[model samples]
Target: MQQDSTSKDSRIALGLALTVRHDGHGGVADDLADLAGLGAWLRAHPGTVPDTERYRADEPDLAAVRAVRAAARALFARAVRPGEPSPADAARLLPVPEALRCLNQAAARTPTVPVLDWADAGPVLRREPADDRADLAAALAHAVIGFLAGPDRPRLRACHAPRCVRYFLKEHPRQEWCKPSCGNRARVARHHERQKRTA
Candidate 1:
C-alpha cells in the first residue's frame, strides 16, 4: 500500500517536473505559461493534488506552480548525479540549494496531521490537512517531496533523448529513455552524430 502511494506521488511529481519540455525547436516550452495553460493542465490531470477539482487557479497560483516545477527540474538535474540532465533547460536551471529551499518552503506552507484511517484491511495512518483551505502548490510540493524521499528515488531519471525534456521512473533494469519514441530518437541522433564524425 505504501509503495503504491509512493509510486503515485512520484508520478505526480514527475508530471509536474515535465511541464517544462522541449519546444520542438531546440527551446524550452512551459505548460504553465499562463493561467489558461495552468487551468488546462489541471483539467488534463484532474484531482491529483489536494483540492484540485476546486482549484481556482489565479495568476499567483500559476506562478507558484511554475516555481515548483523549476525547482523540481533543478533537483532532478541534481538527482541523476554524474549523468547529464535534459539539455532543454540545462542553462537556466535553478541552483541546487535554491531548488531545495523552494521545494521545502512550498511543502511546509500547509500543515497536515497523521490521522488513523480505517480500511477494509486495517487502520492506517494518513496525513490529513489541518484546515479546509486548498493549497494546490503546497500539496504538489508534498507530492514531490514524497517522491524524492521514496524508495523509487534511485529509479528516477531525466530523459536525454533529443528534444525530450522529460523525467521518468525506470520501469525496468534496462530502461534508458522515457518512452520508445524517445529511445528511437536517441538512437537516430546517435547514428547521425556517428555518421557526421565519419564523414
Candidate 2:
C-alpha cells in the first residue's frame, strides 16, 4: 500500500509521545496508568485501538472503544484542509484518533473530568482519574494531541537514529538528535573538533 509520510510521521510521533508503561498490578498511580493506557490505544488503533484494562473492565466494552474511535475520526476530519499550513494551522488540526479515544472513553464515564469538563457535559458519572482510568487515559492521549495541534506542529517529526524507533519534534530542522546514541555521537564529534583546534 502507498504510504503517506506526513500521516505516518504524525502517528508515530503521537504514539511515542503518548506511551506510558503499566505495572499491571493496579497499584500504580493513575497518571502513569493513564499514560500507558494511551500507549495501548495507539498500539490497537493507530487504526482502532482498544480501551486499556486500566481504563475498562475485564470483559471490555467494545461499544466504548467504538464511540471514542468515532469521535477521534471526526476531530481529525475537521482539522485537515488544502493550503500552506501556517503556525495557526496547528489549531485547526483536531486531536488525532488516539487522543479522541482517550477523551471520549473518559467522557463516557464522567461529567467533570479535567479536559472533558468544559468541553462536554452529560451524566457521564463525574468520576475522578483515580476512579475512572479513562480520565487519566484521556489526559495522556490529549497531551500528544494538544502538542501536535499547537503552533509548534512544524517541530513534530520521527527519530532517524538508525534502528531506534522514537519520535521527536526538532528544535531546528538541522538538529538530528533523537536518541542518546545520536546525541553522544554529536557530542563526541564536537569534542574531537575542540581537541584538534587546541592541538
Candidate 3:
C-alpha cells in the first residue's frame, strides 16, 4: 500500500530528489537504476511506494522516472544553492504547470476519506487507494511544494565535502556538511592547505 512518508518529515522527499549524486568535479552516481531498484528503495523507506501490488506487477517507465528525478534535483539545487546554477540549468527544471498537473491528477484519483479521530478529538482525513505511479509523482510534487514553503527552507544545503554532492537539512547553525565524515574530510583538506601555505 502507498503511504505518506513526507507527512512527518518532508525532508524525505528531498532525499529522494537527491538519489542521484554528483561529485561537483565530474563524477556522478545514480542510486535508482530500474523498477526493481526503485521497489527496493521504497521498501527500505516505506510510504514512498504508491500501490505496492501495482509496483510489484508492472515495469516502471525508467525514462519518465529519470526525467522527473532530474527536474526535481534541478529545482532543489536552485533553491538550496542559488547563484551556482546557470540560466540554462534552471530552464531544465519541470515547469510549474506540469508539476501541478501531475499533482492534480493524483489528487483526483485518490480522494480523501474523513474519519473520526478519538485520540485527537477531531475529524481526520486519509487518502484513498493510491495509483502507483501517479501517487509517486504526487508525493514528489507535494514534498517540493512543502519544502519550498517551509520555515526551514533556508536550512537546505548541499554537502561541501570535496567530491561529494549530497543535500541535507542543516541540523545546527554551524553544520556545513551532510555527515561527520564529510566534516572530517573538510578539516583534513584545510589542514593540507595550511601546510602548503606554511611550506
Candidate 4:
C-alpha cells in the first residue's frame, strides 16, 4: 500500500518498537537478541541509522545500541498505549525527562560545512555528526512524536487476530487485522464461536 512519508517513517519506528514480540502461544521472540542481531537489523533498516556505512564502519557500542533500543521500545509503547504499564524497568531505560532531552537535542540542528550535490536533481544539504547514539535516539523519538501528533495517530491499532501481537496503521475505516491472514483467522474463530453457541 502507498503511504505518505510520515506514515512510512512511522511504520519504520513501529517496526523498531516491536522488535520484541509476545508470542501468545508460548514465550517471546526478540529480533535484537544480540549485537550481531542488532547490527543485522540496522543494516536491514537503513532508515533507522543516520549513515548505514558510517554506522557499520564505526562498529557502534553494542551496550549503547541495546540501551537505545530498549529506551525506544519503552517510549513507543507508552506513546502507542498511554496509561498502560510499560515493560519492566522501562522507566530506567528511557524516562520522560531523558526522552524529552534527546528530542530537544535533536531539534537543534547545528550548521555543517555545506556540500553541493546533484543527487536529487537539485542541491542536497548534509549536516555534520551529532553523537550517533543521540542521533538514533532522537530519530526514534521524533518518529513517535510525529506519529502521535499526526492525524493518522488515531488510526494506529493492534492486531486483533488470536495469538497475534502486532500493531498496524489502519488502511481502511473498517480495517482491524494487520493482514488478510489475521482476518481469516478471526473469521474462523467466529465460525467456531457460532457453532459452539448453537451446540
lDDT of each: 0.83, 0.41, 0.58, 0.59
Q: Who wins the lDDT comparison?
A: 1
The TM-score measured for candidate 4 stands at 0.61
The digit string of per-residue lDDT tens for model 2 on 22-47 reads 22342212221343454455455433
In model 2, which regions exceed 4 Å deviation?
A: 1-134, 183-199
Model 1 agreement with the true structure over 1-199: per-residue lDDT tens digits: 1346447778778878878777777777888889888888887776666656677888888888888888888988888878888786588889999999999999888899889989999999988889878777888898888888887788888898987888888777888998898899899999999999999
Candidate 3 segments whose C-alpha is farther than 4 A from its true place: 1-9, 22-26, 51-54, 57-60, 81-134
TM-score of each: 0.89, 0.34, 0.66, 0.61
Q: On residues 1-199, what C-alpha lDDT tens digit does candidate 4 reach at each position?
A: 3456347567666676667665555445777777667667778767665675456422344544444455555555455564343333333346766755554454343223455676867878765444444355445545555666676666666665665555666777888776888789789989999999999
Which wins on TM-score, candidate 1 or candidate 4?
1
- RMSD (Cα, Å) of model 3: 5.6
- Evaluate residue 128 in candidate 2 and report its C-alpha lDDT on the 0 to 100 scale: 39
1 or 3, greater by lDDT: 1
